[model samples]
Target: MGVIKKIFNKSRPSNEKDGIFFDEMKKLLGFKPIALSHYRRAFTHRSSNKTDAQGNPINYERLEFLGDAMLGSVIAAHLFTEAPTGDEGYLTKMRSKIVSREHLNELGRDLDLISWVESNVAPQHFGENIHGNLFEAFIGAIYLDRGFTYCEKFIHKKVIGPYVDIARLEGKVISYKSLLIEWCQKEKKKFHFEVYEDNGVEGQKYFGVRLKIDGNVIAKARATSKKKSEEKASQRAYFALQEKINIK
Candidate 1:
C-alpha cells in the first residue's frame, strides 16, 4: 500500500473521465494517474499501423523490452534478498519462472490488460505473446515515466500483491513444451511437433492443431486458441514421454 502510494503520490479530485480504465484505477489504485500517455503506450499493440513523428513504431515492443529488464532486475534483487541461502543457479531458475513469457502472458491476461490495448489489428488476430509483451511494455513505461523505485513498487503492488500466489505458481506448469524438451534431452529422444490446419464446420471457425511426440503422434489437440491447442498437445506428448525420461 505504501509502495503504491509513493509511486502515485499526486492526489486529485475527479474532474470528468469516468471509464473502465479510470474506474479500475480508482478502485484498484485509489488515485488518478497524472500521466495517461505512459499507460496508453503500455497496451499499444505493434500491429496497429501507428508511428511516431520520428517514423518509429508507436507500440509497446520497446517498452516491453525495458519492462522485461526492469522486471527481471527487481525480481532478481528481491529473490537475492529473500532467499539468502539460494545459489546463483537457483536464483536464475527462480527468476526465470517468475518473469517467464508464459507467466507474464497469464498475468497480463488475468489482469485484462488487453482491454486497454490500442491496435488496428483485430483483437482476435493477436497472438498470445501480445498480452505478455504489453505487460512488459507497461512496466517499462512506468519505469521511464516514474523511476526504478516507483517501478519496483508498482510491480510489487499490481503484480506480486494480487497475482504472485507463490504456492500455486510453484506447482503450476507454465510450458508443457519446455517440460517435453527437458524430458527429450534427458531421454536422448528425437521429438518434434507437426502443425496443420483444421477447418471447422460451415459456420463455426477455422482452427489448427499440432501432433507432437518422439517421432510419433503421441498426442493430438485442436482449439480456436492455437496456443491452448499446442499446450494440450504438448501435455499429451509429455505424458507419453514421461516414462522414458529420468530426472537427474
Candidate 2:
C-alpha cells in the first residue's frame, strides 16, 4: 500500500507544474477543481496502465463511461424540451446525431483536449477515438467534482448553445451510406460495395472499398474497418452526386 502511494506520488507533477495545470483547468472549465485528483484521472490515458494501492487499475475509462451517461441524459432532456413536437423516434435519432463519435471528436479537437492528456504512448499513436474518449472522461470529472448542476451548465455552454441547431440538424445526414442507398432506391439505380483488404501504413491492416452506383464505380475509400471504408466511399459518392441526390 505504501509502495503504491509512493508510485502515485512520484507520477504526479511538481508544484510549479501543478500551478500550470490548475490554471489550465480553470481556463478550460471556467471553475477551479476542488479535487484536482479527479481531473488528473480524467486526463490520464490507459496507455499509462496506472494502478492504485489495492491493485485497482487507474485510468479514464471508468470516468469516460460515467460522462457518456451524463452527456446522454442531459442531451436527451434538452432534445425532449426543445423539440416537443418530435416523436420518440425522432428525438432519439436527433440525440444520436448530436452525440455521435464524429461530433464528439470534433468537439474535443476544437477544445485542444489532447494537449492535456497524460499518456506513456505517443499522441500520434493514439486513434481519433481517443479525443472523444478524453472529452467524455473530462465531462465525467466535472460531474464528479462539481455535481450535476455545474455539469449541466458546462454542457449547455459547450454543447447545446453553440453547436446544436434543430433545423440544420434535422436536414443533416449522419450516415452517408444510408442517404446514398435511399437515394439510389428511389432513383431506381443499383448500388453495391466491393470490400477487400488494403493494408498500408503503420503495419496495420486496413479495408478498402469501391462504391458502385448504377454498376459504375463512383468512389473508392480505405479505412481501418470495412464499414468505415464503405462509409467513406459513400460520403465521397454523395458529394460527387450531391447535385443529383439533392435534386431528387
Candidate 1, which ten residues in sequence have the lowest lDDT sum? 25-34
* RMSD, every candidate, angstroms: 11.2, 11.2
Candidate 1: regions farther than 4 A off:
1-32, 162-248
Residue 84 lDDT, candidate 2, scale 0-100: 95
lDDT of 2 at 233: 83
Per-residue accuracy of model 2 over 141-238 as CA lDDT, tens digit each:
99988788878888997788656767658976577788888888888899999975566666555778999987899988766678877877886787
Instruction: Provide the clash count, candidate 1.
Output: 2
> How good is model 1 by TM-score?
0.59
lDDT by residue (66-161, candidate 1, tens digit) is 999999998888888767887998789888888888879866775667888778778778987877987888788777666788788888876765
- Point to the candidate with the largest TM-score: 2
